[model samples]
Target: MATSNRPNAPELDSACVAAYDHAVRQGVFDDSDVAEQLALGEAEVLRIRTVLTDLRLLIRGEDGSATVPASPEIAEAELSAHLEAGIIERREQLARIHRQMRSLAPVYRAHRHLPQASQSVRLVEDPAAVRRELAAATRACTSEAFTVQPGGGRSPEALNEAIARDTTMLKRGVTMRILYQHTVRANLATRTYTRKVTELGAEVRTAEEIYERLIIFDRSLAFVPQERVGGRPPGAAIVTDETIVGHLWRMHDKMWQSASPYDPRDVDYASTSEEIKASILRLMATGLKDDVIARKLGMATRTCRRYMAGIMDELGATSRFQAGVRATSLGMVKPDPNP
Candidate 1:
């Protein structure tokens, strides 16, 4: 009678095939040793022995030892079975992937229309309205405030309103940082405002070029002017989302890092004199006339001339040419080809 194949025929066939190949190469094997190495029961080993014998792939030696015969047909049959199993597994895997993609089709379609379902943005028209909205947004803030005032000079009413809001917020313990143009250092009203605000614990700084005005509250809301406000109706203001507000706040932080702090009533005459001298040197290097230099530096003509006179006196020069030569020699002005 023919023997029944092992229950795990595929796995047993592959293992027996490998053991046969190795035995053929090595030219020796004990049946008990083979069964132990392959972790097979005696019954499974006996079935493998029968299968190999049927295939005419088993050899019996003179010592009753069992070994494998090198039969190309046996190898070909095992390889074909492995390839068939792999192909079926890959087809099933591809079908599963297609099912998953089909399940996500509705999600993809719903995402395409999400933008239309979002809320519509509202616009604020009047300057007073903008101010009111900004104040309202900031009033609820639990963190710090940042502001940039370009041109440094605002109408008295506008300045008063801003100061009042700042005062209230400061009283409520919100930290504030304000940036202004260097020209404000000379404005009495601006200086007074700075003095008052600094007393309330807000930080102030000055820079040379401030191109636009901005306000950010709690690093979450920001406002920027839409049009130039040079003696015309106030332009529209941009009330920002959190993402844009954070970006503008980062820019403000960069400028604040580079600006000089505003310290009121500290009489640093030498430093003031040095700044005046530096301004004169910069203006002269730019090939500007004294009048243009005066206007650009926010000083009167007489005041500009007085600074030049001081530069001359410091260098002990009697003529403009001598002053320029001495100023360069004393390292007061270095030639800037770009300027």
Candidate 2:
């Protein structure tokens, strides 16, 4: 009988030899019975017989009974050979991978020197400097741009500058997208700004919790605030690495997908209020106080309490605890629309 040429065939043959040895020692089965038990057809059984014969572990008698030979050296040698071949093949594969990595070392080293390198991130300290850097990044962009501004709270001057740049880019057919927090709909200035950008064909969406401002140009360069925009440092910037930029872009997309359309002056604050109410109800159900809920929702504590009062009125509750129970009973906090 011939052996298979498959990669694992030798190892498989060795295992078959071990099983044959066990069956022979058990003395409860003939070779044909062993073949049936092992689920191998006659051809495979013959191959095993040949291996066992080479090992001298089995002797064929004229009466058609099979007897075990004295030695186990042959089986041990077959197993060793199979294992050695597998190890050699694995080592060769690893060597190939190492050689490929070695060939890429120079390119990797060069990339580390580029502005996008991870370790040498620069900080832009002045607003003018930050704007200059962003403008430079815009000029360098060869692909699409993405941005996120939570609270839609850009300064009037900055907003005007961004609108002008976005308008110019839109006329030139560059792709741009921006995301804002749902609160933007209620901010007249932000609504007007978004309307102008939307007229130029840029995409805009809104979410409830937009944490930081992010701008990614061509999926390559990104700018994020190092200090909160209103923080005491005045103006501080952190130029992003490729990995962080990519992550920001992904997060922007996820929020954008969940945001409602930015309809400027036409936005319904009533719906926004309802969303706030629902969020308050969720927090209340968790036993959170108005102050804590206010911070989490990025609103004033008084405003949060006012919203809770409104929720109670809507649910016909006489107290805060009653409002929570009623909200749950009516399932008012069920999954909301993407916005």
Give RMSD to native, each candidate.
22.6, 19.7
For each candidate, the alpha-carbon lDDT, in order, equals 0.69, 0.70
Clashes of each: 0, 0
lDDT of 2 by residue, 157-234 (tens): 668887877777777777888887665566666777888877877888777666677888787677776655565434
Q: After superposition, how far is residue 156 of candidate 1 from its true place, in Å?
A: 3.9
Per-residue lDDT of candidate 1, residues 200-312 (tens digit): 99998876446567877777666776664576546344545666667778877888888778775654545545665776776665567888777655566887789888777
Per-model TM-score versus the true fold: 0.50, 0.57
Report the Cα lDDT for residue 28, model 1: 66
**lDDT, candidate 2, at 167:** 74
Model 1: lDDT equals 0.69
Which candidate number would show the highest TM-score if scored against the true structure? 2
How close to the true structure is residue 56 of candidate 2, measured as C-alpha lDDT? 47
